[model samples]
Structure formats: structure tokens, C-alpha cells
Target chain A: MSLFHWLRKKLLFLTRANLFIAIGFMLLLAGWQVLSFYTHEILLASPAQAACALWGIIGTSYFNENFLITLWRLFFGIVSGGLIGFVLGTAAGLNEDIKNILEPFRWIMLSIPPVVVVVLAMLWFGMGSKMVAFITSVLVAPIVYVNTVKGIEMVDEKLVEMARLYKFGFVMRIKDVYTPAIIGPLGAAMVLITCMGARVVILAELMGANDGIGYALGVTRSNLDVPQLFAWVLVTLGIVSVFEFILLRPVEKHFIRWKL
Target chain B: MSPVISFENVVKEYGGRKVISGLSFQIHSREVVGLLGQSGMGKTTILKIIAGLEMPSDGDIKVIAERVGYVFQEPRLLPWRTALENVMLPMIALGMNKKQAGEKANHFLGEMELSEFTHYYPSQLSGGMMQRVSLARAFATEPEVLLLDEPFSALDLQMKDAILSMIEERLLVQPMTVLYVSHSQEEVMRISNRIFMMSSGSKLDELPIQHCRAFRAGCKKAFLKWTKQIGSN
Candidate 1:
């Protein structure tokens, strides 16, 4: 495509919502720049210093290796955990007995700290990607499970009765009724899980694992490279944003187009 | 002609309170039966039992229809689907392909005079429009048996009259066995071939009247007198 055509196409995707988000980001960056000036360089990195550090990190082979590792672990962790949660949650949502049986497990999972889980995971899986992924999945599953149960329970009874009267088959009931009813809640839960997943993965990697962004952050922290530490944090935030905005948001928007 | 629906001593209880006790009724194929009763008098319960949404605590209920359609009091359209899509759902459930379902949905929506509003969501539509969508959805399925549980009760008189006329027109084109439960005597009189009054005891008493497709002054007078008799009882 010509430059003008490409530019027009891109501009069509931009709306007032994007403009407001851009302005809000600019204001936040300005605030951070002001705050950095008030503190020592070693204590707080300026946005410029962090940006320079991030640019430098991106050029290195270490960045590619560690970032890929973290991304892969995050992908596997979320998929496995989310699937298990969805299946169990659907069962629990349908049957009171299953819900009751799973209640204590959900409680324990929610109540237990990530630190404790990381420590336990290390003992079980050893110092590797497995440990980090396991910890991430454990933290992610309960959130998804709880939201799924709530979503299913809140499906309109009248609609269900209508479905029954119409003799909707099992697959049709799931596709037309249960899936749509749960998508709203599940979408919100997914956004929450992505951010939470990123944080827990890093924490787990930092505590137990030998590679990934968390390990890189740990290395920077030990060397007192504040700008590099901030750079790693930026990269983590970028990944989470990509997962949420690029991946989840489009899927959510497609499913809930009627709302728009 | 064999009855399409037969209820034999059907009894239902909710938490030890007998809502329907030994209710018996039979509805033949293509019969449009209007059910009039006071609130909380098992009118809805009877429809539920017939629809198999609620199982009777005791008795044998036989519904021989291959397909049943229900127009609930509330417009229970899936909020995420458009008007046309909502009408297509039951057809899709019956294993119709998307193209055929879509065509049928469009035809039904057109019949309801909602051809222009086919893409509107339930939340975007007005209350009367939503109810019309519900009616279209029920009709699109080509049900052998249709149960209308006060489908127009939430509508205003003006909208109610328009929809009742649409229903009467649809039934003329495509006749189905319908058990219509409504509180409005005028609405019941306009649509029903026979009117049955249900009492608190879950017993049905058939009221004798010359069946009319449209509400007339003479039938209105007779309906008022029968309603007054019911009230007095």
C-alpha cells in the first residue's frame, strides 16, 4: 500500500478513546519526570534514563532469550490454569455438590500468599521454568474459577427456561446461553488474571528460577542498576498490555458486539 | 381427533403447599385456548407443567407435539444477540442451518413489522419492541404447540392492541395449538377459540361463548358479565 493509504487506514483505528489514553499517558510521564528530578539518580530513574536503558536492553541477545522464556511460561501457565478452572467451574456451577466440594480448595488457594506458593513450588519442581509456571498457574486458577462460578450462577433463569422449552441441545445451550452469560464476567476475570499472572510469574522467577525477566530484574537489583531495573519493569508492563489489549480485548469486543 | 396435550390428575406442590391439586385438561391440535385467572392461581404453573419446565409432583402429563414455543411475560431475549438473531435461536436449536434460520427469522420479523429493527439489541429496543421480538421469536420456530404466558401484559394498551392483532393474523396464516394465559379479558376474547377460567383450587371451568376472532360489542358485554361472575365468586 502507498504511505497515504496506510496512514489513513491506521488513522481510522484511532478514536477519541485512544486520544484520551495518549493524553493520560503523557501526563503520567510528565509527573514521573518531575518526581525523578526530586530524587537522586541511584534512587529514582527518570523516564529518559529508563527509556535509554530499555532501548539498550532490547538490542542484547540476553533480552530476547529471557523475554521469550517468560512469554512462553506465561502462555503455558495461563492456558493450563484457565482451562482447568473453566472446566471445574462449569461443573461446580451446575451442581451444588461439586461447588461445595471445591469450596475449601478455592478458599485455600485464594488465601495463600504467592510467596508461600513460590517457596513450595521450588521444593516440588526444583529451580527451573516448571517451578515458575506452576506457581503462576496456582495463583491464576482460583481467580478464574471464582469468576466462572459467579458468571454461571448469575445466568438468567427465564432464559434458561426458554431454552428448555425450546429444547435447545446441550451444545446449543452452551454456545447460545451459558457461554454468552459467562463471557462478560470471564472477560473481566481474564484482564485481572493477565496482570496478576505477569506479577506472580516475575515474583516466582525472582524467588526460584534462574532465567527470565524476573531473574534479569534480580540481577539489575543486585548490581544497583536502578535504570535497568526500571527498564525491566517497563518491559513487563508492555507484555501485560500486549496480552490484555492486543489479545484479550479484541476477543472480548468480538463476543460482546451487541453491547456497542 | 386425538388431543395434542393431555393432563391427567396433575398435582404440583412447592414446599409442601399445593399449588395445583389434581388438575385435568385436554387440548386438541390447532386449538387456541385462552386461560383467565387471578394472580398466583397456578395459571403459570399449569403452563410450566405442560412445557415440561416443571414436573408434576403427581399425575401423568402427555404432550405429543414435536416442538413447543414459549413467549414468556418478560422479553427474555439474550442481551448479546440482535433481534433477528434472537428469533433464529430456536430454529438453530432445531438443527436449521444459519441461512435458512436467518431467512425464517427475517420473514417472522417482517410479519411482526420489525423488518427495519432486525439488528437492534434488546437493550437498545423499547419495551414494546422487545416484546414484539419475543413474539417473533416464538412464531419463527414454527412450533406445533405455543404457550403464551401473559406475553403482552407488560405492554401498554396501544402496543397491546397492535401485537394482539399481529398474533391473530399470524395464527390465521399458521395455526398451532396454543395455551394463552392472560389477565386481559379483551385480549383473551380476541385470540381464543375457547376461554377457561382457572380458580385458586387449580380447577379449570370452561366458560361458554361464541368464539369470535375479533372483539365485538356483544361479546364484550358477555365477557364483562362472565368476568363479574368470576369476581363475585
Candidate 2:
């Protein structure tokens, strides 16, 4: 395909949903511009000023150091939480007794506020990356567990019976049936948990951590640099979006190609 | 020759309702037995019992076969697996290596005239094509006993004839003891050496076919005559 045609095809694939997202983004920008006109620059940064701030920080050592640290924390938190959740949830799905035992813990984890969990982590682990990672994982794990359980439970019984009739061993049944059955919901859950994990890690950093994008945001807040804080937020969003589109989306699509 | 399958006064019940009571029958090796019944008349229950998917509530049921192939009413192809992969599944389970299973599956798909569509997923295939794949999967295992439960009921008349012919041709070359279940009298008469009628009251009536001018000629003539008499009346 020609470059123009390829680009056009990609654009068309976005559908009406993309158009709505674009409109929402434009409205937010217009509102920010209006607010900046009415308020002091220190109080409300104009979209242009925030963009300029973003450009200023793009190549700086400060930006690179904080961005990398935050990315690392986010990655570790998501991976650890996701793996634990998948294992536990699959066990629960396979056995009613396990599900019953885990029910109370799942509920407790889900019900507790993220702020309280962060506070407890701060008290327990002290102020550092460990604390931030703990808080993020704790907050995200329950959601992953819930989604995994739902996914596994929703697998068709007829398929299971078919597998049994064919004398499929446990591993074969898991590979051919269970994995495909859960991939769709699990993919959606991973996307959700990752996004939530990113946000929570930043919150944890703001509360206690010494380095990362949230720390940078705190620094900007202390200096009354509204434009720079907004710039940091935008950068963080860009990183998360890159992770989602570049890594998760393709993996999800590959695993669930049967649905497509 | 000894009987390959024997159901000796088998009794089955579910939730206080008797589905099959005092059922007794024997299927000899290399024999094709057709089971005719209306819906919910325990014909499928009998197949399931023989397939070891369900148990009899009382009495004895024995099947002396190394492998049993079952073609259910609906083609239960794994939606994710392609036609060839679905066909290879039972072979792989039966201890065939991947390469050997793939080759065998390919051969069967070829026999069913589904060679070109072997890579197609179940969702991509039509109903008739899916059922053909299901048949190929069953036959690929080289099962000692084949159990079919209305395998072609979902197809059009032409598709049904095509599938039936495929099955008949395969059976002729490699005869296996078969317990074929269907609602159609004509179908049962055409395909089976002996026929058994089942009813909701747990009664089974046997009709033995006598060879005349051709295969199933006696049963076919009787079926045609019966249909004609009903039409005339």
C-alpha cells in the first residue's frame, strides 16, 4: 500500500469513537485556554504554555531520570500483581473451596481505599520505591483477580465436556480451551489494571517517594509552576498510552485472534 | 464372533425419572446397528452410556473396543482450532506425535474433500463443511467403534446425501462396529444392517434386514411401501 493510502486506512479504522475522543480533547484544551485567560499564569497554564514546558523538559537529564524511574516502578508493580492475581484466580476458578477461602481477602483488598493502603505501606516499608511498588500492586491486584475469576467462570461447559470426551490431558485442555476462553477478559483486565497501576504509582510517589514523575510534579507544585506540572502530567499520559498501544494491544490481539 | 458392545438390562435414571430402564442389546464386531427414536426417547442416552460419558443407574454395560469415535448432533469443533487441528486432536490424544497426527488428519480431510479448507476455522466454515470436518475428525482416529448421533441432521438434503456417501464409502473400506442414531426411518434403513426402535416407555424393538437384490434392499422396499401406503391413505 502507498503511504497515503495506508495512513488513510489507519485513520478510517479509528471509526466514530476516535472522532468523539478528538472532540473531547479539543474541548478540554479550549476550556484550559479560557481559564488561563481569566486567571494568573501561575494559577492556570495555557495549553500553549504547557506544550512549551513539555518541549523544555523533553531532552533534560531531570526528565529522563524521573521518567525512567517511574516507568520501572510501574512495570514491576503491574507484572508482580498480574502474575499473582492470575495464579490465585485460576486456582479459585478451578476449585470452589479455594474461591471461598480467597473471597474474604479479595473483598478486603477491593474495599480498602488506595490512600489507606498507601498510608499503611508508608508506615510499613518507609518512604521509598518499595513503598510505592507495594501500594501500586496491592491496589491493582484485586481488580485483576476479580476479572480473571469472571473470565474463567464464563468459559463454556460444553467445551469442557468436549475436551473431556476427547481425552485431553490437563495441560492440553488448558492450552486449547481454558487459555483461549480467558484471554479476552484477561486482556481487558490487564489493560485496566495497567492504567490504574500507572495512576496509583504516581499517587504513591506524591505521598512518599523521593524520585519519579509524581515527585517531579510535587517539585513543580512547590515552585508554583503550573505549566511544568501540567507538562509532567501530559508526559506521563503519553508514556502510558505508548505502553498500551505498543505492547499490550498487539499481544491481546494475537491471543484473541479466534474472536476476530 | 463375540459381541463388541453389550448392554445387559441397563437401567438409568435422573432426578427420580427413569430415562432408560431394563435396556438390553448386543452389537457384534463389524456390524452396523441403527437406533431409531423420536426426540428425548433415550437414544442419545444410550450412545452416551456406551461412550462412557454417562453411567447406567443399575445393571451391566460393557464395550469391548480400544477406541470409540462419536459424532454428536451438532459438530462440536473447537472454534479456535482450524479444521485440520480439530481433526488432529483425538489422534494426538491417542498417542500420535504431532507430525503423524497432522499427516493422518490431512489424509482424512482429503477423503472428506475438505483438503483446501483444512486451515479454515470453524467460524469461517459453513454448517455442512463443519459437519464434514467433524466426520473427518471421527474417522481420523481409526476408531474400532463409531457412535453417530444424528450427525447429518443439520444439513440440507444434498449435503446430507454427500456426507452419508462419504461415510458409507469409508465404512466399506474399513468396517467398524457402528451404533448410528437417527429419527428418519429411511435413513436408518438405508445405512444399517439391523435397526432398533426406541420409545419413551423404555421399549426397544429390533428389525433385521434381509439382503435381496442390493444392500438394504428389503428394508428400503418396506420403507418405501410404508411411506406409499401412508400417502395413499
RMSD of each: 4.3, 3.8
* lDDT per residue (tens digit) for residues B108-144 in model 2: 9999999999999999999999999988988988889
CAPRI quality level assigned to candidate 1 from its DockQ score: medium
Q: What does the TM-score come to for chain B in model 1? A: 0.93
User: Candidate 2 docking category?
Assistant: medium
Clashing pairs in 2: none
Q: Which 10 consecutive positions of candidate 2 chain A have the poorest summed lDDT?
A: A12-21
- Against the reference, the lDDT scores of all candidates come to 0.89, 0.86
- The DockQ values of the predictions, listed in order, are 0.70, 0.55
- Which residue pairs in candidate 1 collide? none
Model 1, residue A160: distance off in Å is 1.2
| Candidate 2 C-alpha lDDT tens digits along A136-228 | 888878888888888879988867766777788878887888778898888888889888998999999999999999899999999999999
The DockQ score of candidate 2 comes to 0.55
Chain B structural similarity (TM-score) per candidate: 0.93, 0.91
Q: Per-residue error at B14 for model 2, in Å?
A: 2.4
